[model samples]
Every structure is written in structure tokens, then in C-alpha cells.
Target chain A: MNVLIVLAHPERKSFNGGLVDVAVKQLEDAGHQVEVGDLYAEQFDPVEHAEQYPHSAVASDYFYPLNEQRAHYQQDTLPQDVQRELARLEWADLVIFQFPLWWHAQPAILKGWFDRVLVYGGRYTSRMRYDHGYFRGKRAMLSVTAGSPGIAFQPFGRAGDMVAWLWPMHASLYYVGFDVLPPQVSYGVQGGGIEYQKEDALRIHLNACKECWATRLAHWEREKPIPFAGWEDWNSEGVLCETSPWRWRLG
Target chain B: MNVLIVLAHPERKSFNGGLVDVAVKQLEDAGHQVEVGDLYAEQFDPVEHAEQYPHSAVASDYFYPLNEQRAHYQQDTLPQDVQRELARLEWADLVIFQFPLWWHAQPAILKGWFDRVLVYGGRYTSRMRYDHGYFRGKRAMLSVTAGSPGIAFQPFGRAGDMVAWLWPMHASLYYVGFDVLPPQVSYGVQGGGIEYQKEDALRIHLNACKECWATRLAHWEREKPIPFAGWEDWNSEGVLCETSPWRWRLG
Candidate 1:
């Protein structure tokens, strides 16, 4: 198996980084080929703009990202960084997004990866999404860290539902035809406070979390993807069919 | 009312840009003081990193964004751009986020705005969030454009549920104590391609969408905020209390 771990943290020594290290070692030990897309280390530009396409623009006057994406991709002129990321995606059987949950979502850099790297016409088209998505057969999962503890992320928790925060990302992965696994959330990640860093208990807790991640990766292939309503579940109007069981849960 | 419209689209001539114009005109005509945070025009650096906090560092070795945010905020040494954004929020009674929904969420630039501008310790804290957030009195709403039609965003739709796509963002606003209104989603936004840009029907449709947005802004204050589970509805574990009415729907 081939694995791609995309890390989106600024500090290489952060807990998120630690988790990536653990996953790489664990997956490699399991006899898998692993590649790391260290976004911050590579200085991956998160913002998509006109500058990304100096040549091969379908319309030079107006800068529409989706159009530019489609045009550049068709012309085989996508930016080097985007092309590299795509190539990584093509090489991997499983993709893991490692990042801190900043502001109830993935960090801007990773969010931008979805924005820039996933070219509309080339990667997914109107008819080629959902169950029929481009990267079918691949598996993807999110390994997230949060400043808030586990108790605070339950349904109606002050930290808000972790499931709810992750839904968009999870759904996005599913949209592109990957079997999306449930997220591995490492809660109570102490950030920037000296006491938490110095405390032995916190250190022990973090180590345990790392071990949990390594253990999860060891059995990733056996995991079931999170269930989502696919094309067959919907009617012509694009709403859930009245007879669909998913309607009861998600309606 | 003081209104701040933060736009995240790259092109000022695009349909998203047209919506911003409509909003400014509508709000200003209603005798409201309006300010536009044109992120593209301003060239807002969406990526938050060590460079953003050169002067103020609680711990320089490992960069924890929230810690740096809180420390810089406390010391009154926040980056000038961030301070300016904060001031805008402080001054506004109503905030409108205008953008094209890229990757089933806000564009990375706007996502970064949420990541960087909303200071953790200063704008919100562990205790001072949800119903008791720092921006409790202010109302914030999203004005979004999508390439897919409205029907395509329904539950089980090919484009996925708009509600699910917007939930993370809506929850984030509610987390910060903003009275989040239902988003103004202008769907079927034709992008790039000379045909759609030149089509008379597309022009007519865009005008109608613009009018709809303007009309909504005219009665903005009269509109009720979308209901959310509040602190009172939750138990000690932060889960919705079993006895709470919200438990039936959201549990």
C-alpha cells in the first residue's frame, strides 16, 4: 500500500507534527510506501489568485478560479505546486490529512489545497462527482488536533460537535470518490502554554495519543468508511428520496 | 447600523463582486454606515504564521497561533492588518461575509480571516463563548455564490447539501455569539467560459439575484437569526441535556 500524509501545521515540533511522524513510522513498519506532503515546510501558497496562471488563461481579463482551474488543467499548465500535489494524490492509495482544527475547520493552507489542487474539470465534473468521483477506490481520513478537550466537543458542547465541524471536510473527501473514514481527533492539545508543555501528565497524555494514532494506522484498511447518501438515494430534484432511510437521520 | 462587508473573491468584476456592490448600495441607501473589507484589493495575507507575530511572542520556539494571538492582543502589538480587522468587527453592528463558496466552504482567504482575525483569548475564551461570546450583540451573515444550481445543493443533491456545507461556518459564527442569519446563497453562478458571460439569460438571472440580495439587506434588522443550541440547553458534559427540547431534533 502507498500512503500520503499531508501535514498542515506551522511548527514542525507541534503535536500535529508528532502524529505525522508516528503515522509515517507506523505505516512504513507495516510495509507500506509513505510520502509526506509537508505543506508549511514547502511554503505551499494557500491563496488561489490570477498570479497562479501567468499563461494558458482562457480569459485573461476576468479571473474565475474554477474556469482557470479547468483551462489550465486541460492545457496541461497547472502550477508546479498543484501538479506536484496531484501527482502525490495519484501515487497514494490512502491519504491522511494531519492538522490542527483551527477555527472549527482545517487550517487555511489545507483548505486552500482543496481549493487549488482539486481542479474542477480535470479532477471532477458535473457528471463525475459523488460515488462516481475521480479518485474512486482510494481511502482518506482526517487526523485532527484541537485545543479543547473531548468533553467539550460532544453534541451541543461549547466547543461544538467534532462530527459537525468535520462534516464538510468528510463530505468533500467523499464527493471526490474516496472512502472516507472516521476522523482521529486528539483533543486537549495544549498550545503555547509553558506549564502544559512542562507538566509530566500532559507529556504522558500526548504520548498516549500518539500511540493511539499509530495503532489506528496499523488497522486502517479494516476500517469501514463513514456512510453517506449517494446518487441512488436521491430523486431527480437532487433531494433525498422519500423512501430513503438516510432521510430519517439527515433530513 | 454600521455594516462591514468582507469580500473574498479574487476578481472585482466577477458576479461575487456584483453582489458586494449591490449590498453596499442597499445598506448605504437604508442610511447605514457601510465599510467593505475587500480582501483581494487589500491583498490580505490569509496565511497566519510566525511572521504575523514578529514583535509579540509568548514562546518563540514553538509557534502556537492562539497563544501568539492572545499575547499579541494583550500587549496591543497585533499585526496592523489583524488590529484593523478587529477594529472593523468592533465597529460593526452587522457583518456580511461575501464570497464564492469554493470547496463546499468559504475560500481560503476568508477561512484565514476567521483563523487570524478572530483572536482566541481576546475575541473568545473557554468560558466566554457560545451565547456569551465577545461579539454577542453583533449579527453576521454569509452571502455566497455557487456554480451549481439550488436544486443541486439539496439533501442528497449532486452538489451536496448547502446546509451541511454551510454548517461549519454557521456554527463558527454562533460560537462567537453572532446572531447568524440564513445565508444568502445565489446559486447557478455562471463562471468563466465566454458563452455564459455573454449569454442574455445569465445576465438576467444575475440581475435577479442581485435584487434578491439588495431586498434582503433592506430588511436585515427585521429578520430573525437562525436558532442554535445555546449554553442553557447543554449539561455539564457539554452535550445537549436529555430533558432539553433541542435534544429531540439535534441529539
Candidate 2:
């Protein structure tokens, strides 16, 4: 199997980066081809604007992101970095996002990855998203680190539910047709109550997380993807049907 | 009242910009002082890195974001843009985030604003978050535009719950002690089912949304802020207490 690990962190020696190294070694040892995309190392330009499109397809006066994206994609004139990411996605059977959760979500750099790399007309159209997404058969998962403890992120915890905070990302992955797996969250990565426990305690926790991640990857295929309501489960108005299991949560 | 509308859109002529214009006019007419922070126009760098902290108090080899933030803030040496934003926050009683929803959240530029501007030690400490956050008395709301129609973002709509998508952002604002109001979502800004209604229909819709927003702004002071669990509501481990009113949703 081919795998792509996208790392979004400023410091290469950070715990988030350490997890990427662990993933690479683990996946490679399992006889899989692995490539890591270190976003910070690449100096990825995150802001999407008129500047991203040097070859103008839209009017000089206006910049509609979707229109420009569609045009560039159709012309095969996308930016080099975007082209490289798309190529990686095309080659990978599974993709892993490695990052520290910031402000209850992925950092801005990773957020921009979804904005730029996923071309509209080429990657997803009105009919091409959800179960029919361009990368449907592929899989994606988030490996996140947080500053707060696991208890703080429990359901109704002070730090908020990890699942709820990650729902946008999970939903986006599902929208684009990846079989989304449940996230592997390494909580209390630094500071918070863990600091009172002692500084080296974080070091110990990091190693333990690395071991847990490796074990999970080896037996990953046995796990089922997290469930999501698909097209068939919704009515013409795009809402869940009466028989849909998702109703209980929404209600 | 002082209001700051931070806009994160590429095109100034876009509908998102139009909403900001409508807001400025409405709030100003109501005798409130208002300021607009055009992130794109300012060319705000979204990627936070070691370079952002020019005066490094940490060792040259390693860069920890929170540590650097705390050090720089202690020295009163935060990035100019961040300092400016912090000043704006200090002056404002209410803040409005105006942007089109990209991939179910704020655009990368706006997301970066939170990452960069919310200083670790100064803006929030482990003890100074959630209900006890620094900006507790201030109010914040998201004025968002979407490509999909309202029906598609219903409880279990295909576009997914708008509430779920914006949860991370809402939670972030709440963390920093802002009373997060329910978002003003102007759905179907373009494409999707709206385009079938003809391109000019989007124009009509934009105008109507502007009117609606202006009308709402007139009575905004009366609207109660969205409720979130406070510090008192949580136990020592940070989990919500059994008697808490928030338990119903968690269960």
C-alpha cells in the first residue's frame, strides 16, 4: 500500500513531527511505500487569492475562488505545489494528517491545504462529492496532539469534545470520499495539568503515544471506518430521511 | 458600542465584502463606532513560525509557539499586526467576523488571525479560559456566506450541519471569553441550486441578505448570547457536572 503523511507544524523537532517520523518507520516496516509532506518545510503559501492564479481565467476585476480553481484545473495550469499534492493524493491508498490541534481545529496551513489542493471541478462537483467523491476508495485519518489533558476533552469537558472539534475535518474528508477513520488524539502533549506532573512526563507520554500509533497502524485494516450518512440516507431536500439512524443525534 | 469587523475574502467586490459594507453602515447609523480589518488587503501572513518571533528568547535550535508567545508578550514585543489586532479587541465591545465559509470553517487567513493574535499567556492562561477568559464581557458573531442553499445545511443536510462546522470557531471564541452569538449564515451565495435560478438571482439574494443583516443589527443588542458551560460548571478534571444543564446534549 502507498501512504501519504502530511505534517503541519512549525518546529521539525516538535512532538507532532515526531509522530510523522514514527508513522514513516512503522508504515515502511509493514512493507508499504510512504511519503511525508512537511508543509512548514515546503513554505506552503496558505492564503488563497488573486495572486495564486497568475494565469488569469477570471475577469481582472473579480476573484471567485471556485471559478478560478475550476478554470486552472481545466487548463491544467494549477500552481506547482497544488499539482504535487494532487499527484500524491492520486498515488496514495491512505493519507494521514499529523498536526497539533490549534484553536480547536487544524492549523491555518493545513486548513489551506484543503482550500488549494482539492480542485473544485476536477476533484469534486455537485454530484461528485460524498460517497461519489473522487477519492472514494482511499482512506484518511487525523492524528492530533493537544495541550490539554484527555479528561478536559471528554464529552462535555472544559476543553470541549474532541469529536465535535474534529467534526468539520472528519466531515470534509468524508465529503471528498475518503473512508474516514476515528482520530488518534494524543492529549496533554504539553502544559496544562501535565506540567504540574513534571516536564519529563510529557516526554514519557510522547513515547507511549508513538508506541500506540505504531500498534494501531499494524492492525489498521481490521478497523471499520467511522460511519457517516450518505446520499441515499437523505431526502430530496438534502435532510436525513425519517428512517436514517443519524436522526437521533440531530434531534 | 465599538464594533470591529474582520473580513477575510480575496475580492473586495465579493458578496462577503458587501456584507461588511452593509454592517459598517448599519452599525455606524446606530451610533456605534466601527472599524474594518481587511486581512487580505493588509497581506497578513497566515503561517505562524519561528520567523514571526524575531527576538527569540528561546534557543536558536528549537521553537515552541506558546513559550515564544509568552516571552514576546511579556516583553511587549508581539508582531505588529498581532499587537494591532489585540488593540482592536481591547477597544471593541463587540466583534463581527465576516467571511465566506471555506471547507466548512473560516478562511485560512481568518483562522491564522486567531492563531497569531490570541497570545498564549497574555490572552489566555490555563486558569483564564472559557467563562473566565480575558474578554468575557465582549461579544462576537460570525457573518458567513456559503455556496450551498439553506436546506442542504439543515439538521442532517448533505452540506452537513452548519453548527457542527462552526463549532471549533465558536468554541475558540468562547475560550477567549467572548460571548459567541449564533452565526448569521447567508446560504447559497452562488452555484448549487441558486445558479439554476439564474445568476442574477444571486444578486437578488445578496441584496436580501444585506437587508436582513442590517435589520438584525438594529435589534442585535436584544438578542441573548449563545450559552456555553462556564468554569464553575466543570469539576476538577474539567468534565461537566451531573447536575449541569449541558448534560442533556452530551448524553
Candidate 3:
């Protein structure tokens, strides 16, 4: 399998990067092709602006992102970085987003990847989304690190449910037709570990996390994609019909 | 009342910008002071990295974001931009985040604002978060614009729930001790207008939205903040206790 690990953390030596290294090693050992895209090292600009499209296809007076994205895509004048990221996505069978959970979601860099790389018309259109998405055959997953331990992210945990925090991104990936796997969360990953007081315990915890990631990646291909309702579930108004079978499992 | 509207849209002419204008006018007319922080115009660098902390509070070898944030904040050496944003938050009684919902959340610029401006140790400590947060008295709200129609964002909608999309951000705001208000969502605001079939209908809808926002702001002070679980609700391990009285409302 061709795997693209998109690393969004600023520091290359951070625990997030360590997980990426582990994933690479584990996947390569099994003879799978892997490529790591470091957003920070590559200086991926998270902000999307009019400057991104120098050759404005629409009227330059008012900057409309969607219209410009659609125009530039048709004109083949998209920013170089976005093109390259799209190429990586096209090549990968399974894509892993490795990042620290900053402010309850992916860092701005990765967030903007969805904003910029997933072009309006190119990636998704009026009909080319959800189950009928463009990259229907491709799979995506998030491998996240957080300062708080897993216990803190339970249903009623103080830090809030991590799964709920990740729902939007999951929905987005599903919108783009990628079968998104359940996130691999490495909890209590920070400078001095929130759950671990002693240095030795923190080190052990970190090592254990790496081992866990390695094991998970070994059988990643066999994992089922998280289920999401498709077009048939919804009525003409884009809301679930009363008889839709997935109503009970709704977000 | 001192109100700060932090806008993250790339175009000042966009519908999101129009909402900010409406907000400012409504507040100012009521003898309340208002400041519009145009993040895009200000060129707010959303990516938080080593460069944000030049004084080097922590060792430069391995960049630890929390450690650096703590040290820099303690030393009063935070980046000028962050300090400025903090000052704005400090001054405002009500903080309104005005942005188009890009990729199920705030745009990267606004997302980074949370990551960088809300210094980890400075803004929130272990004991000083949730109900005890530094900005406890200050109220914050999201004034969001989405391309999807209201119906598409209903419970079990084809576009997924808008409330669910906004939950992570809501939790983040609550984490920092701000009494987050229910978001003022202006649905179907985009270049071509998704819900409005005719051009005249789109214009009328937008005007109606502006009127609705103006009316809401006129009575904004009466709006109750969204209720979140306090420290009293959580047990020793930070999970909501069985008898917390807030379990049914849990995310």
C-alpha cells in the first residue's frame, strides 16, 4: 500500500514526529511504500488568501475563495504546494495525518490543508461528495497526540470528548469520499506528561505509545472504515427521512 | 459594553465581513464600544512555532510548546501580536468571533488565533480552566457563516449537524473559561448563494440575515451563555461523576 503520512506538528523531534517515524518503520518493514510530508519543514502556509491565486480567474475586486478555487483548478493555475499535496493524496491508498491536538482539532497547518488542497470543484462538487466522493477508494486516518490522558477525553471528561472534537474532520474526509479510519490517539504526550509525574514513567509511557502505534499500523489495512450515512438516508431537503435506518446512530 | 469582533475571512467584501459591519453598527448605535480585529488584514500568522518565542524561555534543542508558552508568559516576553490579542480579550466584555466556517470549523487564521493567542500556561492552567478560567467573566460567541442551508445542517442532515461542527470550538472556548454563547449562524452565505435560487432572492435573503443579526445584537445582552459542566461536576480523575446532574447533557 502507498502510504502518505502528513505531519502537521511544528517540531520534527516532537512525540507526534516520533509516531510518524514508527509508522514509517512499521509500514516499510512490511514492504509498503511510505512518504512523510512535513508541513512545518516544507513551510506550508496555513492561511488561504487572494495572494494564493496570482492569476485571478474571477473579478479581482472581490475575492471569492470557492469561485477562485473552481476557476484556478479549471485553468490549472493552482498554487504549486497545493498541487503537490494533491499529487501525494492521489498516490496514497491510505493517508495518515500525524499531529498534536492543538485547540481541540488539527493544527492550523493541517486544517488549511483541507481548506486549500481539497479544491472546490476538483476534489468535491455538488454531487461528488459523501459516499459518492472523488477519492472513494482511498482511506484516511488521524493519528493524534494530546497532553491530557485518555481518561480526560471520556464522554463526560473535563477536557471534553475527543471523538466529538474529531467529528467535523471525520465528516469532511467522508465528504471527500475517503473511508476514514478511527483515530489513533496517543494520550498524555507533552513536555512533562500530565498523567506521569516521574521522568522514568513518562519515558516508559512514550515507548509504549510507539509500540502501540507500530502494532496498529501493522494491521491498518484490515481495519473497517467508520460508518457514515449516505445519500439514500437523507430526504430531498438534505435531512434524514423518518424511515432512514441510520437515524438512531445520527450525530 | 466593550465588544471585540475578531474576523478571519480573507476578503473584507465577503458576506462574513458584512456581518461584522452589521455587528459593529448595532453595538456602536447602542453606545457600546466595538473593535473589529481583521485577522486577514492584520496578516495574523496562524502557525505557532519556535519563531513565535525568540527569547527562548525553554532550551532550543527540542521545542516544547507548552513549556515555552509558560516560560515566555512568566517572563512577559510573549510575541507582540499575542500580547495584543490578549489585551483585546482582556478589554472585551463580549468577544465575537466572525468567520466563515471553513472545513467544519473556523478558518486556519482563527484556528491559529486560539493556538497562539491563548497561551497555554498564561491563559489556562490545570486549576484555572473551565469555570475557573482566566477569562471567566468575559463572554465569547461565534458569528459564523456557512455555505450550506439551514436544513442541510439539521440533526441527521446530509451536510452533517452544524451544531456538531461547532462543538469542538465551543468546548475550546469553554475550556478557556469564557461563557460561550450559542453561535449566531448565518446560513447559505457564499458567493453564488447555495440556498437562494434567484439572484434577487439571494440579495433579499442576505439583507434579511443582516436585519436578523442587527435585531439579535440589539438584545444580545439578554442572551444566556451556553451551560457547560463546572469543576464541581467532575470527579477526582476529571470524568463527570455519576451523580453530577450533567450526565444527560454530556457530549
lDDT string, candidate 1, B1-251, tens digits: 99999999998888888888888898888899999999988989888888888864677677888889888888888889999999999999999999988888999999999999999789889788889988898999999998878988876566777987888899889888899989999998977422347778887788889889988888989889998878888777777787888767743
Order of candidate numbers by DockQ, starting with the best: 3, 1, 2
Per-residue CA lDDT of model 2 for B89-120, tens digit only, reads: 99999999999888888889998999999999
Q: Identify the candidate with maximal lDDT.
A: 3
Of models 1 and 2, which has the larger TM-score? 2
Query: lDDT score, residue B96, model 2?
Result: 96
Model 2 residue runs over 4 Å out of place are A191-198, B191-198
Q: Would you estimate the TM-scores of all the predictions? A: 0.95, 0.96, 0.97
- The alpha-carbon lDDT assigned to residue A7 of candidate 2 equals 96
Residue-level lDDT tens digits of model 1 in A35-62: 9999999999999999999974777788
| DockQ of all predictions against the true structure, Cα-based | 0.65, 0.65, 0.74
* Steric clashes per prediction: 0, 0, 0
Clashing pairs in 1: none
Superposition error at B191 for model 3 (Å): 0.5
* Off by more than 4 A, model 3: A192-198, B192-198
- Model 2, residue pairs in steric clash: none
